[model samples]
Target: MTETTIVQYLFKRLHQLGIRSVHGVPGDYNLVALDNLQEAGLEWVGNCNELNAGYAADGYARIKGISALITTFGVGELSALAAVAGSYSERVPVVHIVGVPSTISQKQGALLHHTLGNGDFSVFANMSRSISQVVVHLTDPTIAAREIDRVLRACYVSTHPVYIALPTDMALQKIPSKGLETPINLSMPPNDPSIEADVLDSITEIIYSANNAAILVDACAIRHRVIDEVHDLINKSQLPAFATPMSKGAIDETNIRFGGIYIGDVSRPDVKKAVESADLIISIGALKSDFNSGGFTYHTNTKHTIEFQVDHIKIGYATYPGIGMKSVLQKLLGSLDFHRIRHTESAKSKPPRLVNQEAENSGGQEITHSWFWPHVGNWLQEKDVIITETGTANFGILETRFPKDVTAISQVLWGSIGYSVGACQGAALALKETDRSRRVILFTGDGAFQMTGNEVSTMIRHGLKPIIVVINNDGYTIERMIHGEGAVYNDIQPWKHTKILEMFGAKEGEYMSYAVKTRKEVDELFQKGNEFSKAERIQLVELFMPRLDAPRALKITGKMSEKLNAKMEDTKYA
Candidate 1:
């Protein structure tokens, strides 16, 4: 019979479930448990702050399938709540483990340093339930192993964040480690055989009968880990496909059948017509909100749509329960006859225009948003991790053509600023574990960088080298364009953006920083292939662009938002 402490058991189970590293800050309340993390074969990434740690874990999970974050009871957990909420909204699986006071201290109702000083320890856990898909409080040592497995399974299967409250004393309590022998069962529950067959039959019929069918993928396709199945269905069916902005990397953009990024009305003319006019649109893992939909303007008729979702199979207004995207897509691929399917509508559309040639020809004195993004396409090597922050960076990246094997990581649904930086840390660390030579490239605005820029210290501490390009527009450019063009609130304190690498403790030859305003300087930077491409030194570029300039997509979205917000204001007092 094997045995281990509760903390050791927890970390070992996480390691078994493919979590190679845990992200968080050290807290006095959880020092003992933190000490055991290293012995359990898990790397502990100590971040500058708790929130950034949560963000890093969220990003890491997207690449590695699952990730974990550790924090202290009240203050640390609460600070990381916003990041966890973003994970919940985006459907990224993250296990948030919180270390609480000891059983004796909690039973006596002693005032805790991290608490509100009212002796109430349950308030934060209750608050966490709202954001986490599963919440477990490990007060009983006998069941701690089981509880960890259950919560982690929920996080994996649901593709959402789960919370666990670990009492300090209980973490050191000896528990039977037999549970570690069995891996967490991530397989889907058995679907009703008859219902599953019927759903597959219906899905097969839809696939064979449609003359103008298209596959529209979204973020959930990546989060739910059905990308391979999605790719298979697209190939076997030979249907024209388009990915939402959230799914930029889910499918091969070079494929002939790829229509374009379909962002409702804001989509390119050909892309809009192809998707809206299709007789049967097989939307796989498509869960997006008004922001992603360009103000609820998607023209596809629900009556003609077949959606392979996380929990259910939705086909033309009829919802079949107990069906999942992975199984359903696999079954549909087996039954599909490519000869019978035709992209009657999608075939007529031209390939989506990724770069505007004229913009580059007429280079203004200042760096234009249009020219910089496409030019970036030339510098990107294959298999690089490209992460873009919210605002202009995320939207602008859609115009950039990605090479083969490039993974696009962005917080499209969450739209969280300061996300890409922390995410870069985790992505870089996770990338290193695979032994794959990948460079983590990040594009974030200066405004967002100020929010969580200190997370770079974690990268330096761990010797992770990421090429971070700070879009130094001097303010929140997206917010100014969206609602307040001249508002002082959109302005921010501008730092010498190029000084970041030095400030983060990078010595000579270890890091490089640049500030470029003109297109000439930008070209010169990219020409230094040995400097930028070398994974040994971290690179930072402060790209100075026109403050008022925005990406084509963002400009379109901002106008639509203004009209929608104005309508809302008009109706409020009516």
Candidate 2:
């Protein structure tokens, strides 16, 4: 039987899963395993810190289907917990590998530097169990290969993060390579034939009976890899389709039947009415978190809703378990009788117009969120990857329409403040490996940028050419809008934003930086014939905006958030 080292087998499996790079910071325990990465035909993305590594891994996984993150035991793993938890909350697949002390040392309970110094080795793994779908410690070499495959399979199947703890001694232990001859079973099990048929019949009946039916796509459609099926359903049935904020780019924006986003109370008047007034709504992969749903303000009745999830389908008050959306959507397309379904006029929604008259009239005025976002919608090209931070950028992006095949990355449900900067690094790297011509654009606020800003250096080191747009509003604008308008806590120390690239070690000619305070400057920078538009090298643009100005939808949601917080406080005291 052929044999390979334990760490080698693990890396080989990740490579098989299409992970070309591994993201993490190095430490003593994990140092030896890092050597195996290159041999296994994977690149090492050494992040500035473990947290950033975790966030980058999440971003890579979002684009590439699955990713690997490695960290040392205890401190390194703990630092990445927040990012991994965010992955779990949003259902991204990440394989988290932790290098631990030798089994002999663990058995003797030797005091370790990164440990709690209490001779207890299981504490960190215990903490990780809550956030991971599968947590495995590979102590027995004979079963190491099986355990690794098990956790990796779970990660891909469930579309959630999984954890693996590999002791230092286990890194070099001989393991049989025979199991790798067969690929891990990454396919989802088929639904029960009888149950699936019944569910499909019910869905088809409702579609035929309803006067007006609409399809509502959410993040899960993308997560579950069913975008094609969803599009087929919309096209064949001729039903108007709407997307939630998290699923903004899941469907082609130019589709005539594509309505604007529906975020409960925060949706545009026309969009809100169209979605809520529907007699039947086929909601696929809907994750209705507070912010995603406009502070839990979804007005659609449950009885009129049909929700298709990864593992089940819900129609009216009954749920059909053991049924996944991929097969169901495929079968639904075949069963639908197009002649019986009522098709409405194509949705009137279009990307917000590029030139706002009011802004155009005020020629030299500072850029406002209202004007900037819509203008961006017009400037974006097909196949661009846009990463938005969880502040004004996230809400602002909702107002913009994407070109075909553009992928939008954001953490609406998790809402981690500095996630985008690190995510941009990973995304740029992923795109570089797959499609170098495609651009990676990052829209981040100065406040959030400060948190993971160091990751920019990683981009510089790897020769990544991403356009970093810093929304320099002087402070946390989203927080100010929510509760603290003039409070010092919402303020941040200002930085000379144009000097960031130079400070991060970008040599002259390798990078360009601009500070645009007015609309004309923004236009001049992005217009045709400009170097910024070409994206041939790393560029940073400091976009100046009024500190208090925000997206219209953000203002509405912020007020609702404040009210919810106050109500919770009152409930606590009462």
Candidate 3:
């Protein structure tokens, strides 16, 4: 049998799990493990920094179910902690392998890179104390395979980040391969049968009673891969359906029964009114977070709320209303009053009107975020996937309508920037694996793009071509919104962004880039990128959206900032 190190065993387990890419920058402590990873038939996908790498792995996990990232101890561990915490909150399974001082070195007090003078290896415990499900230290080679399998299985099943500390010397320790076994199937945790029965009975009662009942859903349901079941439930029931912002694009918007994202306050007034006045509400896999439910927890008191949630899915302090979300929905399907018309029949709240209104404003040359997004939306096809950075795109793109069934992947609750590009890389990798023909689209602001832009090379090297559309507004637009008008520090030095694709070894047939200024140019390049005659790599399309105005949310936030700024100025003078 070929001798294998603990590092090799970890990589072998990862390979068995079908994880193709592992993100991180190499440092001396982890060099051995990196080499082991390479030998185990996996690519050590390097990133600009540990934080971005963690976000990339988190994104990959979001799309791929499970992923890993390697980093050295101390600085790298600390840098990646924030993203890992975010993943914990969202239930993304990210396996973090941190290189640490050898077991003996740690006990002997040998001076190590990134070690504090106090000589405590409690750093891992401290950093991940709040989030990770398990923090494993691989000390014994004899149980390495078993322990690794156990911890990896924990991460996958629980959908949380887990840390494995590899001692510097343990990289060379060998272990037998037979001990490792694939984890058992990780299905959703068993629901409380009594509660499940009550939910089903209640849903059956509600569906037969109310003429105007709509099913609402959220991200938790999507995480469990039950959206199709939800769609089927809705179809069988023939009930009108609505979605939360987190569940946007989960169901086809074009379906006559589908009502768009319901942000109770900011939602189309009519949609809100409909939800409020509806005789019954059936929510599937939904969480009643303040941001999602307009601060009024609808399902807080189960006795009063006619809702059901799939149980046992809690992310951090947030305990969602469980399988009530799924089971109740499915149960209601058989009880619908088929004669009732679909909700769209009376939807006074039509899609937002922009072209006519914006044209009247005469800021035709100025590219407001609101104005720019709708145009971009118009360009995308039905099955295209959008990977977005968490900046202006976060606020701007949310305003536009995505095509039915098109996937819009964003770190909405996490709000992590720089996730888009690397996520685009992962998504493109996923596209190739699934043998999908539709292009993976990436929308990122310049600043966020700079944060993880190096992944472009990773994309090219792997032949995973994604159409990267960069909104070159030059700085952190979101920061500017948060910090007010004087925040010039949020800006960055301008780069030849369009040419970087070439610099990254993109061949002529493989990729193309454009610097767009006018709306016409934006339209042209977007059209061309979709059908662009390129044979070598992915198309990198750069559009200089005029920074003439902010998105609606930003504008409101800016007004609030201005008021706060004025109050501060008055206080300073007083």
Cα lDDT computed for each candidate against the true fold: 0.85, 0.91, 0.70
**Against the true structure, whose lDDT is highest?**
2
| Residue-level lDDT tens digits of model 3 in 1-574 | 6566788888888877878778887887788888777678887677767877777787678667789988888888888887788788777889989888889988887766688867787766577867888888898998888788888888886778898989888878988866554443455556677765655554455456656666777877777567877888767666667877667668776676676666655465667666655655666667655445644334232332354444532222334455434444444455445455334334223544334365436566655576677666666677777787777776566566777678877776776678777777767776666645766888899988887898888788778778787888868877776674446788787878888888988777777777777766666665634466232358877778655356665455444545666788999999
For all the candidates, what are their Cα RMSDs to the real structure?
1.5, 1.3, 4.6
TM-score of each: 0.97, 0.98, 0.85
Off by over 4 Å in 3: 1-5, 171-176, 179-183, 287-365, 528-530, 533-536, 557-574
Residues forming the 10-long window of minimal summed lDDT in candidate 3: 296-305
lDDT of 3 at 307: 41
**Candidate 1 whole-model C-alpha lDDT, 0 to 1:** 0.85
Task: Please provide, for model 1 over 1-574, each residue's C-alpha lDDT reduced to its tens digit, 9 standing for 90 to 100.
Answer: 7788988988888898888899998887778888998798888899999999999998899889889999998889989998999999999899999988988888888986987888888899999898899999889987888888889889999999999888887888888988888898988776677888998888778777878888899988888888889878777777888888888878877677777788998877888888888888889888768667767889998988999887888989999887777877777677767777765754335664555687977857678888878778777777889999998998888777777678999888888889989998889889878755888899999999999999988888888888899999979998987888889999999898788888888888888888888888887777746666666678888999888999888998988889988999999978
Q: How would you encode candidate 2's per-residue C-alpha lDDT over 1-574 as one tens digit per residue? A: 8899999999999999999999999999999999999999999999999999999999999889999999999999999999999999989999999999999998899987998998999999999998999999999998999999999999999989999999998999999999889999989989999999999899988889988888899999999899999889878887889998899899888777888899999998888888888888899999999889989999898998899999999999998888999999998888788899986653334444555556556655679988888888768888999999998999999888788899999999999999999999989998888899898999999999999999999999999999999999989999998999999999999999899999999999999999999877877887855678889999999999999999988999999999999999999999
Compare candidates 1 and 3 on lDDT and give the better one.
Answer: 1
